[model samples]
Target chain A: MKRFTRSLGLTACAFLALCGQTQAADDIPTIRVGWSIPAEEMKYWMMRRPDAFPDLGKQYRIAWTQFQGTAPMVQAMLSDAIDCSSQAPLSLGQGAASGGLQAYVLAQHVGERKGESFSVYWAVAEDSPVRSVADLKGRTVGVNVYGSGVYGQMAMILKQNGLDPERDIRLVETGFPGSEAALRAGRVDAAVMNQPFALRAESKGGIRKLFSLTDLMPNTVHIFEVCRKDFTDAHPELVKRYVKDLRTAMALAREDRAETLKVVSEVTRAPVDLLDGYLLTDKDFARSADARPDFEAIQQMLDQYQQLGMLPAKVDVAQFRRDDLIQ
Target chain B: MSAQAILQRLGAPLTVLVLLTLWELAARALALDGFPTATESLAQLPAILFDGQSLQSIGASLARMFAGIGLALLVAVPAGLAMGRNPTLARMLNPLLSAAYPVPKAALMPMVMLWFGVGDLSKILVIFLGVSLPLLYHSYHGAARLDDKLLWSAAAMGMRAPARLLRITLPGALPEVLLGCRVGLAMALIVMISSEMIARQSGAGDLLFNALDMALYPDVYAMIVILAALGFALDWAFEHLRLRLVHWAEPRQDAASGGNS
Candidate 1:
């Protein structure tokens, strides 16, 4: 009887100790970060290269959630499902304004840097008569989404070439995976394609790029990291640690391209052969060394979107911009 | 079992083998960039099933699918029976159901996620929405055709309204309810996969998209095969249960207007 009583007391003590540890750990915030596949989100792969993020487990931990697109990611933020995610400029404007979400930009993920980086392209078959944006007029073009950044870029190029994007081109919504197939099938004259797909098409030797996003919006911040206002309000220090770790990870990813692709391959399950020599190189979208979000470029994109009658109302980027987080 | 029955049992598997063979031929002939041969896709199946993450994802998806169907069964069956019996209730709900019928349930994922968060509840709810309509429609038709004389006889025996509903209407409508369940079962899987694909978080659908996004052609086709196999297995098991439950009901097949009782 005495031995049984002693064992029960020990178990009770152990349970109490565990509860105390949990309580202490709860004080350190774990940020729920959202990301999509094929975009090469560096922070999502940070755990694979733990040495890159010094403050990963010490100051803050990340609970990464994969999403299909930025639209759903924004929905997740609105519902408090995720605290932050890497968002495109168009989505950022729409999500904040429509959802009444106080989403703040923390740091840039990928963008055009001095016109020496990869951007989305509208490519056609090499034998096709279409050689420029104007030539695409009265032709059926393929876009992944109507209002996505890629689509916005395509629309801007079309407008500059004096063609109505809505009237002239019958924009078929071909998903990124099916873009090459759709183009090769003669279903589309040109398809707006992003990294890896663009690289794959290039390597295959039939597609000819007419114009890229850079041709229209030079030095554009295509994607940037964003956090919910509530998360930042409650856990400012955690957000700061996250930014610091993100910057460190970005710098390391830039330095060791081979190692970075290995981690990306592990996370995405894309064969390293497909990613190597292209991803994180000059062929990929440029990542800011210090992880800075360009407020001016973001505003310019929003203004252009508003002017093009895409956005319902004008969104001043300053309302959602947070310059304090990007150190 | 007799020889005829044995051959009948073997028919589906034989068809599957033939289809796979044809796929192999077509893929090899085309030799498209991202399309993989049938053998290559089948070779990837073992790896996918054995992987811990993949199994967990699929398991989570199945859990949600079942939960949604179970919830629909609980709510839709009784409501459909009541609607079937009462013309007023049927009149009220018919238009609403008709309106919602054409709206793809998967398209509601974003709004559902916004309301319920990107958790199991939201996914289950969308699957429930997808499944409920078919179950309700079939169950209502089943109950509507329940011989009024049989119900009247039960009433003459001093059976209360609720008791008659439980005892007579439920069993009478069950075959149709089960048929609805069969359709709902398929709808459940469709909604589950599509919602997961749209949400792109975790599940069989997410796994499929992940493979697609990564351009892992073999893995993509392998995931499709797994989903197809899962749908087939579930349908076969449910069909067996359905047959056993409605053994006395005269064999009836679906038609353009309605099936003969």
Candidate 2:
């Protein structure tokens, strides 16, 4: 009986020790920012520069986490596991309406105006009769899952080209990388592609660039930087500093075009010369210190995508936008 | 071996053609807005396949895959064989493997990134972790199932310990060991795609994610076909090798085993 009690006490002590270690892990000073970057890829692409962050992560601190997919990043922010990051604005808006996360749109990547469209193109075999997005009606078009920003952008593109995404094109969520390969294997007629990927598909002779999303939705659909409201409540200055530094980085990317090309090339592993032509949005990234994100324009895009059944109608997008986090 | 078998061998192309025809019908007849009409998807394949960048990415994926699997086998086989031979050693290391074995390697991507900087090393290690334990379990089980009397008889014949292990123990465990290899190979391919999807800058997995990001459905399909082909070839080769190497250990019901009887 004595041995049993002694062992039970020891077991209790061990469990307490483990609990203490986990709590200490939480207490360690960290700015737990989540980004939907492959961590290795980020180290290769963004952080190689000394000035990418002030004092190179010394002044404040960082505990950067990388998520495999944007969905998890969305969940992490809502659950308070993360404080700040950029994610698909469409998901963020819908998530906010449902009370899953309390976040607000704070920044933008202004690529749409400059022809730097984060677009999905209706591509076909070069010799095929499909000429533009119009010709693609009644054809299978690939997009990511329904609420994903990729589909919203694709829907806007299709709508502009005189085809309703709901009535004209067959939408299937075959998933990434697989979608492109499916197109080439003749499993699907056309799939949307991102930039380096679009460039990649074009280099192959069989596929032709049918139409880009920019041609359809110009300056309407884009990526956003959303922050957890509670984090903004606590470290407002840190968030401001992050924005100030990012604005400068975007500006540096433009003014020092040659050096920027070199850095992006090394980071992206694209040839430096090839990355030279890669597009950037100045109005979004190189914001004037006093400038605020264009929320009305953003809300319009959100509402359009929402009405298109791309985002939830329940999201009061006004609440999704917070000026509190803006520097 | 027969004409009917030959007909079966020629079925793959016919199947693909039949599938294409049905796809064409679906788009034409159903006015399907949800899928690509047949002809557009087929004509896009060849041009996408010959891409220099795409080919390079495939080659990169293959190289890393082999590197990860090869290093895992080198460590796993010998270590597993040793643990299989000695219960004392197995007991000592059992907890280490058990504690980690159930932790899904995919969930550890963030921790892996923190420690290994999200490079090739991290990716390889993640795949390695997923493969090694299954191989170890197989090795240990294979050893335990060995015919003890055979080893005893070999020792009675004055066979040296090393010679007995090589001639009797190894041959006895091979059937189970090969089964483990089949699983390990499939698992390796799966982890390769998952790791690339989660963490890497390039590879077929990266290609798929980028394709999704861009909404190039055709290109996404093309990558899927390539990865599928790669997996099929790997599995087929392993099966063929298994049949050839372990022919002597054919199941009791097989023609070879009957001949031996």
Candidate 3:
């Protein structure tokens, strides 16, 4: 009887020790970050490097998560499953305004540049007679998602060409990689594509560029990094460290083409040649690593979305910016 | 076979052909770019079926569907049997089952992904959830509604409990179980396709979705055709299997409709 009692006591003590250990582990400052696939999110690639962001890792354990698109990523943020994520500006704004998610834009991940650099392109089959946006009347076009940045750009472009996006033509939602095949097969008159898919499709040589994001709205922000407002308020230091780590990684990626290509190739599983064609140039990096959100550009997107009835009302772009965290 | 009987058998095929003709005419008349005529979609089917990528996608989707339905059967059948036999177990599970039955399985997808990751396991779980409820309900009803005369006869014959359950109760329940399996199988395919479209790296759903993204309208139609053929073939196979296993049971009128009794 005494032996059984002693064993039970010992088991109880051991269970308590385990509980305490778990509590300590839980207290170790962890942040879950979400990213979309195919776009080659820089922080995820940088995290692969053993020597990169040493201090950040030491300060906090980074839990990285992958998502298929901005909508899912935004869903994760709303559910408190992820503290931060990268999303298209239109997605972030629409999600914030509609879902009532307290999210702040931290930095621009991809944006439009004048004639030198741009991320999104509208492309059609080379054999097709459709020369311009005017030719797209009563035809089908493709976007990655209905409420995504690509869709916004397509809508804006259609409007610019005196076409109503709703009644003028049909817009189908297609993934970036799939858009290339659809364009080739004549499934759509044009597909709204983003880098490195646009670059890859161009290299294949049967698709013609119908228009670019810059063609419609020059020097605009397309995609940006965002974090939940409550998370930033509660863990300001961790958020700052994350931003610092990201900036350092972006700078490193910009300076070392070979290293960046190696990491991107590893993450995306694309060939080095494709990565070289897409990433190894000043013009490419210019659009990719802009560390600050252009408020004017963001406002332009907001106004455009509102005008198109995509957003319920105009949201103040400045209110969503977290320049302090980025700095 | 009599001439009238043969003509009656051709009704389904004739209706299908008529629908296809209408569809082809409508597509041509509308002249909608990217909307393929039935002929265009059918012509592309051979190439799509032969493509390595498409074949792999079909295989992956089928594998997930079978695995999910198999898993659902493994758990649901036994649990359902136990619940139907014991009033206490039925009371415990019926409320919970009914509560969950009406909830959209897709809504649970995000939570499932959080738990299982965006992999085959998550998609399988979604399909499993979708299939298991109808299976459980059918199984419970099958066991619970067993003829009292048969049970009384088995008891009077001095047959043991296990033997009676195996020989009489289970065989009697086979028709309902098979009916549940058929419904579950169809649900499994639908849930699998939706989950794949949302969370997949590859599958028939991904193939269809990607094809649409690239604006490959004929490929999209071809995928739809393949999915329809797959569902029809599987349903036919299940019906044959059911007729074989439950040969003693009265032929159900609703069997042709594939509808629940």
Candidate 4:
């Protein structure tokens, strides 16, 4: 009877030891993510909520930082201040072509589709005489920035309409909110707007959409998730887990609209009505949260940028894409 | 001028040249990818200067800067003079000025835009707000602290208040007022550039920002050079005007120092 008791005690001790080992293995470090204030990248914001992805919080802590644009985001990623971020294809291409950054695609932020996707719009005052892209000649136009995705789309659309982006129209770099203000004030003939701002401008009833990016280039990839090559190499499993958590958050957002809207309103500090105007349609959620990198679309964007003389040389899109991470 | 004076005059330009040379060398040694060498930027200068759009941008920026400073002077000089001559006005305005001086003028940009709309007026008002404070302060002190002996003599000579102000007070205060104008001019340029960068369809700041966004490093550097040259030329012109206007006042050793000296 004494031997039986000793054997039971040893079994209990072994079980406790196994439990402690498992707990130690489950411990997760904090991951820093840089994002902008846009609905497309709000998945990261939603994941921060307690009920959004409980398992994600259990596995890892997230630290979120907001940046104004992808240029500064690239700077942060290069300096190792951020583990990952969302970047426009033009910015990613510029960084890669300049040899300043090497990053792997993790997911898509916005995708282009025929007659469905909402990307960027060229807008004018409601009473303006400008009706089409051809009317842009001798008129001042506004872009978020010159090397940004909006600027690239503006150039492409103007070029397609037989207008030279450089000579035919005066392209001024007016920021997003400022662009709308500039348009209303008659400062610029047209201003490029995206996402919530585009919808907000439309609902405000003063600005008219001159054209959209979809009108010129269909099936174009607008923005993507990127992590430094070194970060991915060091924390391969962490990257996978982060992508999985992001995917889960995306799914939850689509599955539960009311909760997603509440989170979006809180994260953006925008009014619910404005968000409703922005989120009323699936076409508004044209941003794909897919983990797999869209290689064909990315290649097409790279080719366009190369043709525009924005990239120094053509880059191999495959070299920057890591499909295995998502797999 | 003596050879030492010549060397002293050349000191600033020489320092700039050395720094630029070091920048070029460092860029080459480090193989900096996006940054352009000083020489490369210099090579792009003619292109920028010859570009019609760039020239128009420079003109627009200069015009805005001058217009802002001009408006500030129109209001601040008279108000400062009145406050200096009248203690009642001084007591009323002094607290307001003291309170508003420390507030960053850039923080008022959104409010100014809402009031004035996002046109040249908003930018001009921002510059005006930034510059008027320094000008008002200096002008008030300049006119307030007139030599009592000069005023007494003018009064004794039967000079009325208007003539006394015209001859004695104005001449006595010219030096300080010119100093204010010089400082205000610099402030106006700085504010103009910053406001233009924030919201503008055309200006040197806008050109610089657009170039940076396009990754035109050489063009960006070239724009900086142009802006620096423009600022220097304006400062030199103001200094010349100050010397000519306030010839009786003792010249300070440092030409670049502001009104506090």
Candidate 5:
């Protein structure tokens, strides 16, 4: 039996090797890019814009994957399925610790200091008499899945509002659109959300923002671009091109609001006017040079999160943030 | 039937009412954030019924779920029968099965994405992989449980080797096979959601994830309710088909007939 199994294994390995060799001939040092949002978002925003994604268009055929959240997108990069994807601050912190992947976060938000406040907002039904966080005690507050931006932001928001999340509000892991509906239906008291859903709720008089997490945790890193260490090592030039394209796209988005809004609205399926008012005008990502928060601050917050028994299976998150990507 | 009997006859609807009542109490008492009270969902059911995108998402999930289950059934039942009939082959594959017995089927999803790309194939394969196990095991055991006397009797009666094997062995195994089918059906729905939750950009799972992203608790519950219904409906269809075909073989059997469960 052992001999038979051994023979079978050898045959399978040899066949795989031969197939891989044939396929490798076509590999051409390809780079795969995973995106949390659809890739269409980038193309629509950049195609006509100046120098944005030109490098991307030239050398790399970005394989845009719409991951549910940043958690597994980081996992995918860590596992070597792709070169880069969206990274969560907490997940990035954990990923950096174990030293498997070097990842970094550049501010991925569309920063709009003047336009609209697209930074995270928490809200409930407009008619609900819950005026302050104190009234939210023992009420259900909705968030996206655990360990996600929504979860962390909501927790932080609650804490800042003088409401201890662990003590006062029962945060439920309700999805975003569902959370909006729940608020409308008077199911949840509040939810931590981003545009245009928040704007949608507010516009309909369906919901109202009680507080913004942005106000609570200023410079609280929302999202970042995470990359693999090995990929960066093998093709530094390609990674550079990827970042350059992202920056260029971000720059064009800042320079050309009208065009950017049209494209973004098409890509995200958000109405142009709503997106113009909320997303394009409100939250624009500024290019952080190092593409990361300081290691100590990042580490400290994550450690606090871990100590709170929020993290499962500790990781070397520091190592996951490849400084070279930002450098 | 009398009025009391008619009301009693409306038992299925009554069960649904009890379920709704339970859901409402739980949602309110628990102060469920982002989850709809049962009555609210019922009130908003019209929006779901009228919405094109919701229907499309539901349809997309159903297609992936059914296609995956169908593929699994096609492969597992026959292979299981083959293994069941051939003891030598079954023993030879035992180690292969046991090697990865405890590994979470969902963990291999990234590998599936690498191999299949982030397309329908990855989701389908995930569902297929999840459903295949109990099926292969149960059906193999079912085949083995067949009466050796029946096999000998058919052989003695001068039935052709293939015909004797097929007619006696397969029917004897059908009940166990149907049980495997039930297990596989339930598993397919679960893994389909999980796989879609992981890499899929559309489908009911994706819809649910999107709702979560937007913190739309009501839509999330709506999608979940839709998912649960899909599972129940699939299970019922399988049960119905199984009962129609195999109930005759139950104890006190006096006649041989071909029927759907």
Candidate 6:
């Protein structure tokens, strides 16, 4: 009888301890963050540098999810699988236009800054006779995706060079990994590339740049941070902390090049020497210091997509513009 | 076993060796940095297997795949058997199956993910969807081709409808059902890899694409080799089990030679 009573008392204590741990874990809310690329997203940096994001595991915990592209992120947000994510301007506009998901821009991550080297470059075989964008007529050009900012830039550049983008040149879909090889193998006459690919291709000594994203639109906002409006409304404090952490990450990348490159190398699994030449430097894509969204630049991108007939209808940027959460 | 049997047993390994030789030759001739040679690719295998994260990804992928196919077999076999026995049921479900046949299961990831979230449930559901159709199609034909007289004899005896199905119809359809399972096994692996590639959360497919994204050419080819070897091993094991289960049935032509009904 004495042994049975003692065993019951021990079981009760164990149960209470388990319940307390469960309640404590439940108390700390998780912010499900989504990112497509490694170096391009803040999550990769935030993961390695915990000191920069002091509130990360304290006020809120981060649950990281990697996506194939920003387009899939729209659906993920619609399902509430991701509370916040990195977004391209085109995806954000489409998500808002679809009416099922309401995502608000929190800050800009990648944009064109004046006097800095452009991140995206259109390159062709160095030995080829095609020296200019005009020479790309009747030839095939490879872009990452059909309705991406890169494709839009290519179309606008072709138009600027007096060639019909649709009727004159053939556009093929190629991913960044295969784009350089495709260009080299004569599968694509020209390939649009950004950092790593562009840098690697240049180092290979056979690819020449024709034009860049900066040459077409100097101040266009390429990628930015976004959160669901409902999520922001529900947990405004967590959102604010997240935005603050993002700015801190950006500042860390800008101020400390060597440390940033180490973290990037760990995340991207690319050699530090290969990335040292461009990543987070003046040659890299510009990030906003204050985590502010450039509404005008975003509007310009939306207008460009609309003019290209990529977007069916005009999206008013005002509806999705919310930067109040950024400290 | 005779010499002929020994030679037949050695055929698959010999074919793999020839293919690898050709790949090595072509890779050397092309001299493309993107395409790594077979030896270089195979060298990366030890690292993948030894790494904790890669092993976890592979383990999770296999678990989901097995779960998906197990669920598929449970539901699809019964429905297909019923449809085969009843002309009216077959007529009702044929249109739906036909409409879904041509649609790529991987393309349904976005819709499935929207409803189920990007979790194990969504991945398993997509694989289930992919494996089900092939199983249903084959199992239906298997049951349909059963000898009516055998079923009739069992029914004429003291057997009920369910008992006749169990004793007579099931045995008669065993060969066809096993063939369906073979096809469904391939579909399960296909859907599992492609779905993981699309979702990019965690899996062998994600591991493969992550290598591609990082420009780890050798790692990418290594992953392909691993997946290919995995597929080949699975098919070989299943074929052994199938032969044991349906040893009485006459040998069918090779699956690659379009022997499938």
Q: What's the lDDT for all of these models? A: 0.85, 0.65, 0.77, 0.75, 0.67, 0.83
What digit string (tens of lDDT, one per residue) describes model 5 on residues A117-205? 45566786777788886788889888767666446656765666677878787767766555666666666788766655666656666
Q: In order, how many clashes per candidate?
A: 0, 40, 5, 0, 56, 0
Error of 6 at A59 (Å): 2.9
Docking quality class, candidate 1:
medium
Candidate 4, backbone clash total: 0
lDDT, candidate 1, at A204: 81
Tens-place lDDT per residue, model 4, B165-238, is: 67777677778878888888878877877776444545777567655543456777887888788779989988
Worst 10 residues of 5 chain A by lDDT: A106-115
Which candidate number maximizes DockQ?
Answer: 1
Considering every candidate listed, which one attains the maximal TM-score? 6
Which of candidates 4 and 6 reaches a greater lDDT?
6
DockQ of 2: 0.08
Whose TM-score is higher: candidate 1's or candidate 6's? Answer: 6
How do all the candidates rank in terms of DockQ, highest first? 1, 6, 5, 3, 2, 4
- Score chain B of candidate 2 by TM-score: 0.79
- Best prediction by lDDT: 1
- Per residue, candidate 6 scores C-alpha lDDT tens digits across B18-110 of 999999999999988788999998999998899787898899999999999999989998888888888999999999999999999999988
lDDT (Cα, 0-100) at A117 in candidate 2: 33
TM-score of each: 0.88, 0.55, 0.66, 0.52, 0.63, 0.90
Give the alpha carbon lDDT tens digit for every residue of A1-327 in model 1: 999999999999999999999988886669988887765456755857766666777677787777887888888898898998979888878887677878789888888865578877789999999977888878989998877777876788889999998899899998777788889989999987877777878888888888887787788887788999988988888888888778878877778877888888777767788888578778888887787888899998998888777777989988877677775
What would the TM-score be for candidate 2 when compared with the true structure? 0.55
**Over the stretch B214-241, how does candidate 5's per-residue lDDT look in tens digits?**
4446656776777777778778887899
Looking at model 1 chain A, which ten-residue stretch has the lowest summed lDDT? A38-47
Root-mean-square deviation (CA) per prediction:
4.2, 13.3, 9.4, 23.3, 10.1, 4.1
Error of 2 at A236 (Å): 2.6
Question: Model 4, DockQ value?
Answer: 0.01
What TM-score does chain A reach in every model?
0.94, 0.74, 0.86, 0.85, 0.74, 0.92
- Superposition TM-score, candidate 1 onto the true structure: 0.88
